[model samples]
Target: MANDPIQQFEISKILPLEALGTDISFTNSSLFMVLTVGVSAAFLIMTTSGRGLIPSRLQSISEMCYEFVADLLRSSAGSEGMKFFPLVFSLFVFILMANLFGMFPYFFTVTSHIIVTAALALLVIGLVLVYGFWKNGFGFLKLFVPSGVPAVLIPLIVLIEVMSFISRPISLSVRLFANVLAGHITLKVFAGFIPMLSKLGFVGVVGALLPLGFTVALTALEFLVAFLQAYVFAILTCMYLNDAIHPSH
Candidate 1:
């Protein structure tokens, strides 16, 4: 039914393609992902192309994004983390744009799918692992062994740290995927009520006011959530990168 809130997440293939016995079709989700990348890249490139001293509104936004992610990285990982600014910044922009795009009717939310968020989470963690070992060598193992602890509990602590490190991607991906999925579903469910009640003439229309109010409020909240989730993901990425940079610290 048109009122089905969960239907918003449906992924349909736009162009059917197959290769090596695998379905590699272009999908609505894929389109939105591409659109998100294209739009964000274009906006940032064009807005900052002028390099104006007195920045235009678009340029100001672009600058703000750059500075915001930079500050977030520096705060979590210190000056050393600036080297990963491009990765963190791209992630923040991509997630923020993908989330905002979903606000439009009929647009698919790429991050709403666990597969997408999981891949991002894995990428961050993968980098952390590769860099941590490469930079520190076996000294990277120091990450799981805290500096101060009783000898008896050292093994236990290491095990705990190892598990916690292993769970990073799972937590990161679920946090983003779940928040986006729930928020959109709730917004759609409430929004569906607006038209349903209106069909019942004046009395029903009057009754629809409650859900209408809820829908409006939810829309506002979802926008905030979209930004917050991006920030949270980026900050966590910085923290993980910090461990890679200074595993023993």
Candidate 2:
């Protein structure tokens, strides 16, 4: 089981619960999600609790994260979009923490699962739809209608725009899930080689060096992908929200 890459993703029930006919068991995925939220909240709270003339390392990190998400929202959605800072910031931190936690041995990667990522993507898209309609009413439909197009081509353009809009959740969720899933699987494959080669002979032990080197490099790359995926998800959310805020454009 230790050598099985797919085994790491298996969700085991921690506390089984059922309501009527539905199974609502707490799972490994659930545990990690709760941990991610708690850790993210604690980090932000601890870092910002104390205000001083000179910032501490934790304070600096928290501030930088705040500014980073704020800047992303500002650039993508404009100053008006700062209203959604809490939502965007929370998503960014939760995903970033979940991805980083998965790097540790035996830790479950929540974002690697399509169910988790899809839920998040749907939440963002749902908000966009709800707020878009509430803010713009029927004008929200204008998002599918471009500002300038020949009358003959308007119908085809609207159809394409509608399809693209509908695909946001799938693309957003798959991008994060696929990258994390593939990276972890590749790391596990190389890691498994290290022990297998060492078991062969002295020459085999020396040959293990190549896999070890690749594993190290891949681990570093996964860390960057972790941060980048979170940023991409958050920024894309902002862009979608911008459309909701200004559908005509």
Candidate 3:
């Protein structure tokens, strides 16, 4: 059990409870998610509460994150997309915090689960669908119809476009889920090797150092991946919202 890499991802009940014959027990994942939200909110609030002209480190970080998402929204969806800044920023920070929190020992990675990622993906897609229709009416269907296409190929292109649009949530959720799940599994497997190698003779001690160094490097890389994944998720959301704002193409 000690060497089982997959065991770390297991969700065990911390406080069991039942409601209407359904299990609503709190688990490690729930705990970490709550922690993620609380910590993220507190950090932003506390850092910016002073409203200083000359920014401190934490204040700079808050301002940078604000500008980053704002610029990303503008670039992807144009000035009109700034209206959705709150939604996009919230998701970016939440996912970023969740991913970073999971990097710590014994912490549950909420984004690693398909259920969580899928829920988030569905929320974005659902909003896109609702707003697309509400804002553009039946004209939203034009999103699947490309301009200047050959008459004969229009039907085929529409079918492909429809399929691609429907697959967005699946692809988005799976991308994050797979990356976090695989990364943690790989890190755990390599980590398991260090103790095993150290138990051997002199050669084993030297061998252990190799895995230790590699593990450290991988951890750093994972941090980069964590941030990138969050950015990708947020940017993709902006692009999808763009389709809602301008469905002509």
Task: Give one digit per residue, the lDDT tens place, for model 2 in 1-249.
Answer: 689989889999999999999989999999999999999899899888997558899999999999999999999999989999999999999999999999998999999899989999999999999999999999999999998789999999999999999999999999999999999999999999999999999999999999999999999999999999999999999999999999996
| Model 1 / residue 123 / CA error / Å | 0.4
The alpha-carbon RMSD values of the candidates against the true structure, listed in the order shown, are: 1.2, 1.1, 1.1
Q: Please, what are the lDDT tens digits per residue for candidate 3 over residues 45-158?
A: 999998999999999999999999999999989999899999999999999999999999888899999999999999999999999999999999999999999999999999
lDDT of 3: 0.95
> 1-249 in candidate 1: lDDT tens per residue?
988988989999999999999999999999999999999999999999999999999999999999999999999999998999999999999999999999888889999999999999999999999999999999999999999889999999999999999999999999999999999999999899999999999999999999999998999999999999999999999999999999985
**Local distance difference test values of all predictions, in order:** 0.96, 0.95, 0.95
Q: Which stretches of model 3 miss by more than 4 angstroms?
A: none
Flag the better candidate by lDDT, 1 or 2: 1
Which pairs of residues clash in candidate 1, taking residues 3 or more apart in a chain or in different chains?
Answer: none
lDDT of 2: 0.95
Candidate 1 steric clashes:
0
Lowest-sum lDDT 10-residue window in model 1: 102-111
lDDT for 220 (candidate 1): 94
